[model samples]
Target: MDDTPTTTRPPRWLNDHEMRAWLGYRRMRALLDLQLARRLAADQGLSEPDYDVLTSLSDAEDHRIRLSELADRMLWSKSRLSHHVTRMQQRGLVTRQECASDGRGAFIVLTNHGMATLHAAAPDHVAAVREHFIDLLTEDQLRILGDLTDTVLAHLREQPA
Candidate 1:
């Protein structure tokens, strides 16, 4: 404390209005995430992470992606994804296949059952998302949200990795 120096030319901090807005956004985001998780858990017996993996597989070119690539896309650590995949494979929701092109690389391929479950859950999941978030917002608000998210993502991407 004795060695610390105070600066008069510091960066501008968020003002009262900005603070309120930022906090409101944070609270709403947290609540909405909880609501979505609860809804999905109750309706489909799937956790958010479970649904994320299933949905990613459903959208992939052939319901499959390389294990490492899947982990990267999901922003999960390799060990975590591997363990999750192992559990899912045991559940018969997905299977691992050796990559012919690369002996070290394996693919997490979603089974037909997994695809079916995701397909069945999609409508309900989307409806819940809409009811809880999108339906309440006006088109302009949605556009602004999209823009805000894009801006934030871009800014985050610019940071040192």
Candidate 2:
């Protein structure tokens, strides 16, 4: 039997407007993330992943969450999160506690130091966000961007994993 797969039709290529939008979004995402990460590291001594993990724990109930759950929420693999958590733990930013109900499970708890660091860093981060991104857009543009993202995210969530 033949094993090669065949398509019924040729692929549709992106036109000028679609290509512009796609490339613009890619460039913007890359540049914005780089700028934000650099500012966070320079001013706060925190990497972007560190900030994300800290924020996730802070938002959770009692400032703690299961390691697996946190990994899923962050869309990170278990191993990656575990290694990162270990680094944060060494810094006294967070700690790991055994889950009593599950022998193999652990919880990542944000420490007081982590909370303090987040509080200290938040103002500067917000200022940088405003300076680099939010302030550049008009109210209408912001609203449209929000709507567009919501639409895209909704569509993405509807797809099979």
Best by TM-score: 2
Candidate 2 positional error at 134, Å:
0.7
Model 2: how far is 158 from its true place, Å? Answer: 2.1
Q: For each candidate, what TM-score against the reference?
A: 0.89, 0.95
Q: Write the per-residue lDDT of candidate 2 for residues 1-161, one digit (tens) a residue.
A: 99999768877999999999999999999999999999999999999899999999999999999999999888899999999999999999999999999999999999999999999888888898999999999999999999999999999889886
Q: Specify the poorest-scoring 10-residue window by lDDT in model 1.
A: 1-10
Task: State which candidate has the highest lDDT.
Answer: 2
Cα deviation of 112, candidate 1, in Å: 0.7
- Report how far residue 5 has shifted in candidate 1, in Å: 7.1
User: Residue 16: error of model 2 in Å?
Assistant: 0.6
Cα deviation of 89, candidate 2, in Å: 0.3
RMSD of each: 2.6, 1.5
